[model samples]
Target: MHIQLVRHATLRVAYKGRTLLVDPMLSLAGELPATVNTPNQRPNPGVELPMPAEEVLGGVDAILITHTHTDHLDEAAVKQLPKHLPIFCQPPDREKLQNHGFEQVIVVESEYVWEGIQLYRTGGRHGTGEIGEKMGPVSGFVLQAEGEPTLYLAGDTIWCEEVEHALKSHRPDVIVPFAGAAHFLVGDPITMTKEDIVQLAQAAPGSQVFVAHMEVWNHCLLSRDELREHLTNNHLSERVQVPQDGEKIEYKR
Candidate 1:
C-alpha cells in the first residue's frame, strides 16, 4: 500500500487495485479567503501547491471526502474534479456534492465496500464545548483491503473518546492523524495538539501515525518543526511521519 500526503488533509491512497484521492484542496495559494482571525490572515493555503492539480489528480479512480470543509474540498477541487468520477463522502455532504454537479456521490454511513476495499466509518470530535457542536458532523475512516495494510484516516479532530474507540476497535496498522491544532480566535483548538499527539502515540503503540493538516493554514497553531522536535524529544519520532506535499510513502503488509 502507498499513500501520498498532499497539502493539508488531502492525500492519495493506493491499495490493492484502486487509487483513491481523499479530501482534495487543489486551489493555488492565496486563492481562498481567510477562515479565521489571525495576523497572517492574508488568505488560505499560505503555501503554494507543490505540484500541478492534474498531476495530483492523475490516476485517481475515486475520491473520498471526510467532510465539506473548504480546506478539505476547496473551490478549485470541486470545479476541477471530473463530474463522472465517484465521490465517497459523509452522509451530510451527499446532497451538497450532488448539487455541485457531481454525477456519482456515495455516502458512507457506517461501513461500505467499494470495488475491493472495505471502508468503515469512525466518529470524530472536531473540538470541545459549543464550538465543537457548531463544527458540524465530521468522520474518520478505516480502510482495509485484501493483502494490504489496514489504514485509519483520522479526519479533522482532537483527542477524544471517539478517537480512543477507533484505536481500540479497529487497531489499524497505519493512522493518518490530523494534528494541526487549528483554531479560531475565540475558541479552543479544533485539531490535535502536541500533548494529544503524545497521548495518541502512547495509546497506539506500534501503529504508524502520519501527521496531516499542518503548516498550510493560518488557523493551525502547530508547525511541522515543533511537532517533530517534540516527537524526537519524547523518543517517538519514528512512529509518526510528517510527509511533505507530493511525498509518497509505501507500506508493506
Candidate 2:
C-alpha cells in the first residue's frame, strides 16, 4: 500500500489496483480567507501547491472528501478533477460537490464497498454544541482493501464518544488523525489535541498512527517537532508518525 501525505489533510492512497485522492486542496497562495476569526483578522497565507494539480493527480480512480471546507476541498481542484472520477462524500457534501460538476458522486453511509475496497463510516464531531453546529457535521472513514492493511482516517474531530465507539468496533492497522488543536478566537480547540493523539495511540494497539493537518494553517497550534517530542516522551514514538508535506510512506502486508 502507498500513502502520500500531500498537505493539509490531503492524501493519496494506492491499494487494490486503485489510487484514491482524499481531499484535494490545491489553491493558489492567499486565495483562502483567514481560518481564525478575530477583530484584526488576517487572511490565511496559503502554501504553494507542490505540483501541478493534473500531473500529481493524473490517474486517480476516486476521491474521498470528508467535508466541504475550502481548505479540504478547494474550488480549483473541484473544477479540475475529471467528471468521470467517482467522488465519495457525506450526503450534504455530495450536494455541494455535485453542484461543482462531478458526474459520479457517492453518498457514504455506515458501510459501503467500491472499487475493491470496503469503506465504513465512523462518527466525528467538529466541535462543541453551538460552536460545533456552526462548524458542521463531520465524518471519519475506515478503508479496507483485500490483502492490504486496514486504515482509519479520522477527520477534523476531538476525542469524543462517537469516535471511541468506532475504534472499539473496528481495530484498524493504521490511523490517520487530524492533530494541531485548531482554534478561532473564543471557542475551545476544535480539532484533536496532542493529549488526544496520545490516547489514540494507546487505544489502537500496534496500529501505526499518522498525524496530519498540522502547521500549515495559522490557526493550528502544534508543530511537527512538538508532536514528535510528545510521542517520544510517552514511549509511543514508534507508533506515531508525523509526515511532512510532499512526503510518502508505503506499507506492505
Candidate 3:
C-alpha cells in the first residue's frame, strides 16, 4: 500500500489497484477565514497546497472523511469532488454530506467493506470535559486488505484511553496520527502532543507511525521540526515519519 501526504490531514491511500482520498482540504490558501483566538488566527491555511487540487483528486476511487471539520473537508472539496463518487464517513456525518448533495455517502458505524478493503471506525476523545464536548463527534479508521498493510488512520484526537485500546486491538502495520497538538488558544490541545507521539511509539513498537496535521493549519501548534526533534531524542526517529506535503510513502509487504 502507498500513502501520499497531500497536505495537513489530507492523504492519498493507494492499494489493490485503487486510490482513496482521505480528509481532503482541497482549496487554495487563504480562501477560508482564520481560526479565531488561536496562535495563528490569520486566514487559513497559512500555506498553499503543495500540489494542485485537481492533480491530487485524480483517479480517486473513494473518499474516507474522518469528520466534518473544515480543515479535513473544506468548502472547495464539497464543490469540486465528483458528486457521484462514493463517500465513506462516520454515522454522525452522514446527513451532513448528504445535505451537500453527495449520492453515495456510506456511514460506517462499526465496519464497512469497499471492493476488497475493510474500514472500521474507532473511537477517540477530541478533548476532555466541556471543550471536548464542543469539539463535536470524530472517528478514526482501521483499514485492511489482502497483501496491503493494515492501516490505522487516527483522526483529530488527543492521547486517550480509546487510542490505547485501538493500538492494542488493531495492531496495525501502518498508523497515521493527526499529531499537531492543535488548539484554538482557549483550551488544551485538541490533538496529540509530542509526548503522546512518544507514547504511541513505545506502545506500538511494530507499527510504522506517520505524524501529520501540522504546518498547514493555524491552530496546529506543534511543528514537524519539534516532533522530529522529540522523537530523535527519544530514539524513535527511525520508526516514526513526519512527511512533507506531496511526499508519498509506500509499504511493499
Best by TM-score: 3
Model 2: lDDT equals: 0.83
* True-vs-predicted CA distance for residue 102, candidate 1, Å: 1.3
Task: Locate the minimum summed-lDDT window of 10 residues in model 3.
Answer: 34-43
lDDT of 1 at 130: 94
* Index of the highest-lDDT prediction: 3
For model 1, state the Cα shift of residue 79 in Å: 0.7
Per-residue lDDT over 208-239 for candidate 3, one digit per residue giving the tens place of the 0 to 100 score = 99888998888887889999999999999999
Q: Give candidate 2's error at residue 114 in angstroms.
A: 0.9
Q: Global lDDT of each model? A: 0.89, 0.83, 0.91
Give the lDDT of residue 71 in candidate 2: 74
Candidate 1 per-residue C-alpha lDDT over 93-208 given as tens digits, one digit per residue, 9 for 90 to 100: 99999999999998898999988889999999999999999999999999998899999998988999999999999998999999888888877888999889889888999788
TM-score of each: 0.97, 0.95, 0.98
Candidates sorted on TM-score, descending: 3, 1, 2
For candidate 3, report its TM-score: 0.98
Model 3: how far residue 63 lies from native, Å: 0.2
Candidate 2 regions exceeding 4 Å error are 36-42
